[model samples]
Target chain A: MYKEPIFLQPKFQERIWGGKKLHTEFNYTIPNDQTGEAWVISAHPNGPSVIKNGPLAGKTLADAWNDHGELFNKSKDNHEEYPLLVKILDANDDLSVQVHPNDTYACEVEGVPYGKTECWYVLSAEPGAELVIGHHAKTKDELTAMVENQNWDTFLRRVKVTAGDFVYVPSGTIHAIGKGIVILETQQSSDITYRVYDYDRTDSVGNKRELHLDRAIEVTEVPHQDADKEQSVSTVHQLTVKKLVEEKYFTVYHWHLFGQASELKLNQDFLQLV
Target chain B: MIDGEATLTVDGKTFEVEKGSHFILPHGLSDYDLSGDAEFIVSHV
Candidate 1:
């Protein structure tokens, strides 16, 4: 039996307002022969767990996932669909208020096989960093009026966030990662995001990114005011029901901790491709 | 269930496969038709 819990090095991306912070923290040491990229961890058509020691020393996580599917209960070939995409995002500037379509919407409207459902574990934040999730408007008419009249302040529920906070974002939630924050996001392997608002910011081309106005209008829920309680205060174990407002084809759990351990008993015909 | 490409010598043959990229071989191929330095992960559901 293996005694060590595998360590997954993270991947880094350079976004328009993203900082060089995530690249520095999560990347591991590479040997002289291996290559390194801004993106370190790859949930390739291959897997998520990297082999620490053996003949296949530098092989990727996907390769291990394919070879050892039975131990994790994953189907060898089809297991490529769920890549454990973990990233440390440093938002030097505010991100767009965005919503993701679930599997059904993605498959029907956009013809994507998978949709994004991600969670954020905030590692650090500035003095007044805030996250925009959902809205105070209860009805579609109120939400439309708020967006049309540019009542961004009243429409968005601004929650003051700090380090070590876990925010589960199911598909279709209108949310954004505010500036002055660094976070680790874990989610499904899909990269489809629907932007609702961009804080009126423009790209390098000097054009505002397109907003998914109609879809956001259909998907946004009433603002969740008590999002801070999602973190585990006393212990590293927190079981917050994150998908109360929206449901998806898959369920996810957020574990915020240091030196924590838990046992998982597999009773279902499912796979645990860690 | 197909053979690895590293084993095939005649080479200019292709087949349709959705599940794997490097494991398929042409018809009338057998293990004796293979050569040195060939390895592949065999999986079945």
Candidate 2:
């Protein structure tokens, strides 16, 4: 019997490649200039969003999901945790080249409920901004050999991007967010990242970040292929709906409201995030 | 909502929302009404 919208407070995370754009662009009171990501709508144990209104005010989204399952149309047969996470990332510098495991690997090896299969909606980008999208390896052996030989230039595929662009990075896809890019990301609620490579950047303590080479080699898709997402567009009243990517885990849409529209919350089992 | 202001009525409660406002309309809620001029980007599972 729930009504009213649920507004959640974002939790910020700091990273070496982070910047102040989350604050500058979103007017969020970022913790520091190095803040990298704002977990806007999340229920992960690492950083759950706090509800800001109604009877659930002050409760974490995790609490609501576990306690008030009906709000999410959860039934007794479904025991899985919340299925999605939304984030805003600001890459002041290049992020580490990385890949993530799929559900089977994540559960069997990492003991996590879900694996990370994420999509990015570029909020803004600097001129010539590029991202590591995939690799040039023809096979798993080639991929391993290139990684072992440190032949980065010949092994990685970089793509130029700009504002309003959308990229879908599926599980096992070797990818990285290049410098000076800000994006909104939607993904499975998991944080298991296997860093394939870092640009030899050292921390303040003069220690280089650890690289999960073995796991990365194990999970990365050899001869990486870009995901094929067929976008569809439609309009209802003042809202222009753009279907970005529809996959097994989740379907993402971009809604552009020009004037006004009366939206009905149909008897769907899942809640909507804005 | 991304831009402009709006009054959102859910059940018998009302909320004032403006640009940059992010919200989730819970499942099973009745037909909520939004009146005003605004832009928004929304997603769901």
Candidate 3:
């Protein structure tokens, strides 16, 4: 029986808003100065994590899910590509205002298995750091008018963030991560993003990024609703555990171990990404 | 014990782990041994 924990090597992605924080903070050997995200525990085809130890060493997480289905306790009812992805994002600049489709919309329009409904655990933030959460649009017509007019200052809602703060972002929410912040993100496996605005920022080659205005309008919720989350704390073994959010996509928790704790590898019927 | 040390033994192979070290004990490994003290965080799906 496979009982050893699988440690995976992270895959990094370069972005226009990327920076060197991933290297300075996590001591990661980043690919470049524009490294924006580390796909820490992921099985997505774009950047699947490679197992670094044990019998699975050198194999991508996607490989294991496809070949050794038993490891994740894959059964008839759970046969949708890998279900989750974990990432650490370093936003040196603002990300483009974007939204994502849910499962039904994704499968019908994007031909993907899942949609993005992510939550962020703030790792660190500079003083007065903030992020774009919801929009100020009270109705679909208002949202459309604001986007058409490019009225960003009056349309976006920004929220201040600090270390240890948690934010749940469900699908169809128009959001973006502002500059000077690093976040640990957990979400559904799909990566179908529909960009609404890009701040007129051009790439190194001076080309503006594409905006999917039509799709964004179709998928985004008419009025934004913040996720209602009530965290609960508990002690398990010698670790302090805090439940972050339990939603349709996933249940996330933060564990702080103060001493040595022996944990048995039980058959959980599901894989964990840490 | 973020400031302490711990020795983790998996399948009879033991190693000393300290603060800021990140390691995984994969599934299917036998009951392992962890001695000493240390601090860490773990998350699972």
Candidate 4:
């Protein structure tokens, strides 16, 4: 029986708005100061987390999920990619306004099993830090017009955030992580992103990144609605558990340990802890 | 999870989890132990 915990090595990714906070905070051996994200517990094909211990050491997370279904309590007859991913992001600068497609749109167009629905647990946020959670457009046509005109000041919506905040970002919500924020993100195992705007900033190579306005507008939900969740907290011995979100794609929890908890029983489903 | 080192016990084996270490508690494991002074975020599909 596969009883040991599956340790994963983070896969660092560089981004235009990336910074050195990942290495400074996580102590990861990053490739450069521009490291933006660490795919901490991922099984996606783009950047799978490598197993770090036990017999699975050196094997990619995808390998384990494909070869050892029992470990995940998945049926042998079922065939699907691992459906959850955990990431740590350091946004030193503003991220491009972006949106993601739903599962139906993803399957019909991108031919992927899941779309990007994600949530973030703020690890650290500089004072006055803000995020573009949604937009002010009342309709799709309005949103399209605002985008076409580059009317960001009046078209975008912003919210100030602090450390220890939880943000839910459902697919189709136009959002961006503002500068000076580090977050631990739990997301659906999909990499498809539709960039809506990029602040007219060019990369180190002096070229603008491509924008997926057509697809982004097509997938974006009109009249943005905030996904508000009622949080519930409980204590299990010394560990205080806060249920951040339990949604269609994933259920997330924050565990604050005052000391230690021993002999914790596991449920049938596999859990990714980060 | 993200934080200081956490001591974990699975079956009869013990593992030391460092800061920023992320792991999966796969199925078929009945009970485990976590002894440390740290925080963690756990999720499932």
lDDT of 4 by residue, A1-274 (tens): 5678888889999998999998898889999988999999999998999998888899999999899888888888879899998999999999999999999999999999999999999999999999998889998899999999999998888999999999999999999999999999999999999999999999878999999999999998889999899999998878889999999889999888777798898874898889
Backbone clashes under 3 angstroms, per model:
3, 0, 16, 1
Quality of model 1 by C-alpha lDDT? 0.51
Q: What is the lDDT of residue A144 in candidate 1?
A: 84
Point out where model 2 deviates above 4 Å: B1-7, B35-39
State residue B21's C-alpha deviation in candidate 3, in Å. Answer: 7.1
Off by over 4 Å in 3: A76-78, A263-267, A271-273, B1-45
- Indicate the DockQ of the complex predicted as candidate 3: 0.34
Stronger candidate by DockQ (2 vs 4): 4
**Least accurate stretch of 10 residues (summed lDDT) in model 2 chain A?**
A265-274
lDDT of each: 0.51, 0.85, 0.79, 0.90
C-alpha root-mean-square deviation, candidate 1: 14.0
lDDT of 1 by residue, A189-266 (tens): 666777777878876799887887887776655543333332222221221112211123323333222221223222
Best DockQ among the predictions, by candidate number: 4
Predicted structure with the largest lDDT when compared to the true one: 4
Q: Write the per-residue lDDT of candidate 3 for residues A124-157, one digit (tens) a residue.
A: 8999999888899989889999999999999989
As a whole number from 0 to 100, the lDDT of residue A85 in candidate 4 is: 89
Comparing chain B with the reference, what is the TM-score for each candidate? 0.28, 0.86, 0.76, 0.87
Model 4, position B33: C-alpha lDDT score: 83
What's the residue-level lDDT of A91 in candidate 2?
98
Evaluated at residue A227, the lDDT of candidate 3 is 82
Interface RMSD of each: 18.6, 2.2, 4.1, 1.1
